[model samples]
Target: MCAKNILWIMCDQLRFDYLSCAGHPYLQTPNIDALANRGVRFSRAYVQSPICGPSRMSFYTGRYVRSHGSTWNGVPLRVGEPTLGDHLSEIGVRTALIGKTHMRADTEGMARLGIDPESLIGVQVAQCGFEPYERDDGLHPDGPYAPDPAYDDYLRDRGFGGSNPWEQWANSAQGEDGDILSGWLLAHADKPARVPEAHSETAYMTNRAMAFIREAKADGRPWCAHLSYIKPHWPYIVPAPYHDMYGANQVVPVVRSGREKENPHPLYASYMEERFSRVFARPGVRERVIPAYMGLIRQIDDHVGRLAAFLEEEGLTDSTMIVFTSDHGDYLGDHWLGEKELFHEVSVKIPLIVVDPSRDADATRGTVTDALVEAIDLAPTFLDAFGGKAKPHVLEGRSLLPLLRGSPDWTRRAVISEYDYSQRRARVDHDVPVADCRMTMVFDGRWKLVHVEGMRPMLYDLESDPEEFVDLGDDPACEAERARLLGLMFAWARNPANRITMSEEQIAAAYDTELDANILIGYWDEAEVDAARKARGDAE
Candidate 1:
């Protein structure tokens, strides 16, 4: 089978139920919902990690965070790790990245190996094996670690008229005093963004992606475009019409109450005490921010419609595979917590929709499955779609092509997610050591277990209390189930950790032993040597 074009769209911090297809009460999201209707939507898709950097690293490499060692944002993905781009390239598929990768280059690793950090090969190795069309990690000009210089430069060229145009024109808003209110300040969530809709980051990125598609199509090559958008992530503000699209009535009642604070688990109690988490619980905060959040999502949906229309108009719809998902989900105050990093459905459960235009996939069109899926499965799915052979030693994830085509059997029973808050330096300001500040979430449909390194375990009976209000970890009746789940986790942890996938020369050299090379002198003489060389396809 020949490889086809693949469009992998990742929206940042989008919640699972915020779309009409996902049962949002007020949000229509017709464009995004239309994809779900025409494709197979997995109801219980979970990310490998509930945080951005680690989760995306897992998605690109098709490996677990434990395996990749990039446990948080700003941590380097180990040099030489194979990614989706690398695997797709093996099948002659041209892979290009158009937006945020959250990749922190492995400078130390490159320097240690005497590799140039700015070289062509080094750039590809640093950016998760992707050939960059345009790389933006969504950091503003004055961002702490690194500024998105490209975005800032683009904004300035468009006559934004500000010293820091990225923050001033694109992300800030006019206050009651007619002063600029920066979106980075959480207090300005309800304000309208100062930038016009046409010049916004979302619009700019969509056009960039469209441009790449046009150029790649003209090259007459099979390609995959990673269209990653950073929005609804934070700074919760939108431009003009979107900012006023919804208001207080549109805000759904929060999923939590004061009851969760009563005798909360150690981790839960710690998170609730956080300033970010506490601020969301303040009166009027939810009402003020949800409108902008909804607006950001609305904008993403509209852009998705534009991309889909471009595919159809250019006659590329049937020749491309469209997969839409998020790196992780936003809590949106679901469990009295502000951000993602938990095992709760609100934080970990993401929306996954796959549209395979092949005739084999027609049987499952518009179907929704409750099957367990993970973000890591994306790489192997693209590999299968591109007719590439997945390397078992490299890719820990299994392909979803079988499941997407309506096969009755499943490849995974329990899905896993993990988080290491230790490296989240600012967030982990307490005296806790980094060694013991990690957590793993292992869940099947009926039960969920949160295994912490140095903290008490948390178990939730999803069948009985799906909202996870009660912790069954200490309950005597759940002891056997907990043991079973613990054993499964332990078993997974025992797997081999070898990273080397031997090269073709290494395989050939293994058979070119001294005895094999000297075999011509054995019994039959030089006559058999020529026959052996011909058989091995190395004949003169």
Candidate 2:
């Protein structure tokens, strides 16, 4: 029961119901499902944001999106923000990231504040606070067009000769005309990845993770390795057997129809008409892409099994807490949306499986819970699992230790997620100004509400309509419930720490010792200033 080791495995854009244990009809992800069987599968887990970078920042920092202020992908997480790596590292646990973090360093902040961008602290802040065992943010050779030389060097050392093998092989397919089909293009979604299965990014990252686990285990030091996989994300293509594993026949029926567009919610309708959403909704397009997406997930499941096997082989399974989750879920044409930006369940809800190798979790093994868990809860959970407490002044998330120990009820009744698309140039097709273009989601297990700035909220009764086709926001019968859910959303979003690091309590404590420096305007007249200073503790 001395398991202080944490193995956090995350897959990018994995859905909540894609595993067999989660009632997925098409995908038989037995490896991930087996972990669920041995642990607790949270049926209603959600992310703080429906995008990658912000969601992961929430996860790693145990802070809500507003508190951390890394609102979107490529948005720099503010410097000096505490993260799980910072907390765990202070407690003698080595923290490392093996795969993608989608983090961008705050160069502007660093330069403006005169902080050294090349310092160890600066790099840690830029990498979502994880030390690099083998840092690979999944963009290599060519992606989001970032320059990545680490994986490129690995490729060269392994005899994969090319200036950008990522584009040439890993993400490309060999066409019959000897042309290269770029996975970045939807035209090549059906093509198998030109990279050999062993050299695929997923495989290489998994190997790096295994090596890290082995190295850390040898030293017997407590460690948390974030074995993040980048696949099942985009460029929807896979290598070898996984590439041809499932086709359109294996894909679940499209969760949309002309009916959605008929009475579309203004925001929802606008998203459907966008170029990306339009392509996903187009006929034959999904048939070509979805299988590749599923294939990438299937490969991830295999790797999960491989890691589990490695743990058992090394006799570390008994002393390591394994938690599997995703930053967020992909829309994959759900509700006629292409990617995850909206507040749909397909974008915000994700699978959360936790295996706590402790006596307290024995009875809960293989049980499913409907607790409203957020991505931000992860860092606090890990901290609590290791018998450490979160710095109340730093982390804004509640720990899931009670749930892990089989608590019947939860402190939180609803989960919240949000997205700010104001900076993106994508057309909203709405009369609202771009600055006010944002979205938020609140799911209370039964009732779910989506609120968009400058627009009427979208509401759904999930108990009756789990797939969320019906919008009851303006429905007279649901008015009361809508008000209640919106109240919860408002209260949750009203945290004084939003766009702030210090909590009110923390601020009060810090100022409590500064009463001698208390100088106030308008609190007292100038004639009474001397008397006020004498009455207070500030008198010289």
Candidate 3:
């Protein structure tokens, strides 16, 4: 039989709890719900890192950020790293990327990191293995302000002028919302530009992906396509039909009473709550934002629905495998944060679903598995499906096919996530440079240990405190368990060698410099030096 077509859909900055299938009542994710009903849902799948680049690096390389070295947004993915696309393409599968590929930021860090000035107009695409057909060069949320130059002239008419542009705009009543005149006009209920354009971001992405699928199908070859959507990432703006999905009152807020003293990260105490509160503060904002987010989700769900419908219509549904997940998650008023990269449940835990259409009735379908899976496992899983062996070069992930087959011994006790030194540095004051520090997290089924800054570590008993507002790291009683977790962490760090061999480009760029130093100082260099000296003495 021909290899099955693979479709991987990645939603940017999406919280796991926002799905109706995930028990979110206010969010309407009917398409996702339907997908879940037809497949298996991983209830405890977590991203390897909470940030965009690291998590995506984990996804494509099947290695943790520390091992892959694409830890920060600006850093490139070592060009030669064996990616899902590289492997799949090698085995007769055409791979295509569409929309919001944040995996690597080349060319002055513009295309992948969303930092280019042209990005303001939405035209920035084409990095991270994608070829874009249409790109939205101007879709920011704090947008869509009045277009009439007379409006500003009216402000001038009303005797409102200041020293600076923002100061002039924020003249007591007006604000610094990012929306310009064209965007503002579009935001109006009765505007022509509000109509969905053939080149709007979502529509363009969906259209191109469909075209790619059709072409690949016609070529009679298997294909792997990554349809990544930039919705709901930030500047939280959704187009119409999505804009009015819910009432503000109906949007549920993350519930946390008094702040706890457990987490010592500066962001935990100072910034998190304020961000959440700000989003919730605006009148009807929740209703506006939640439904917008849901609508955007539904929009993607619509794409998924269309793709699925096409598969079935073309007699390919049963011959394709569909995997849906996200790169980390958004704050969306949960814990009062907005964008992700935090260690909170809403930020780190993502929705992971896998549908194997060729599975037997007895195979795991519509099942919710609790195995501690991480994004790194995805590459190996895809490779496994294509009759490829997962080479062990620096790949710390395991295949899920055995788990899917219900092998009794197939179990992963823990999954690990490591933050880059740069992001951890962002958490503290400049005076306390965290460059020398590395954080490693290990979570078993019920317990989590966070070793940060080489200081006293943190332990959370999720069974007791699901919110993770309390840290049990200081408890003397949990010492044995703590030691065991530490042992596991050290063992992972001490892994002699991993297999998924890298290309020369990847080896130089993605290899963790810091981790390599530790290994050289503590492991390989001493043995090599001794061998060299002994050879010299023997010659003498």
The C-alpha TM-scores of every prediction are: 0.92, 0.91, 0.75
lDDT of 3 by residue, 1-540 (tens): 223788888888888887888998777777777778888888999998887767887887777777767777657665445566666666776667765555543444443444553452222222343333322212222222111222233234445443322112311112247333232211231111232423335555677678778877898887777877665564344455655655556667654544543455543444444545455544555454565566667677777787788778778888777889999887665555556665667878999988866555236777788888889888878777767756656456777776665666767778788776544423454333646445678988788998876457778888998987777777899999899999988887886344455644666786645443444444457778577556756876
- Per-residue alpha-carbon lDDT of model 2 for 20-102, expressed as tens digits? 89898888799998999889999888999988989988998888887888888887888777889988888888899998887
lDDT (10s digit) by residue, model 1, range 436-479: 78888889778898998766689998888878888887789989
Model 3, global lDDT: 0.64
* Winner on lDDT (1 vs 2): 1
Candidate 2 vs 3: which has more TM-score: 2
Winner by TM-score: 1
Relative to the unseen true structure, what is the C-alpha lDDT of residue 407 in candidate 1, on a scale of 0 to 100? 91
What is each predicted model's overall lDDT from 0 to 1? 0.84, 0.82, 0.64
TM-score of 1: 0.92
Runs of candidate 2 with Cα error greater than 4 angstroms are 142-146, 423-428, 498-540
Residue pairs in clash, model 1: none
- Window of ten residues with lowest summed lDDT in model 1: 423-432
- Candidate number with greatest lDDT: 1
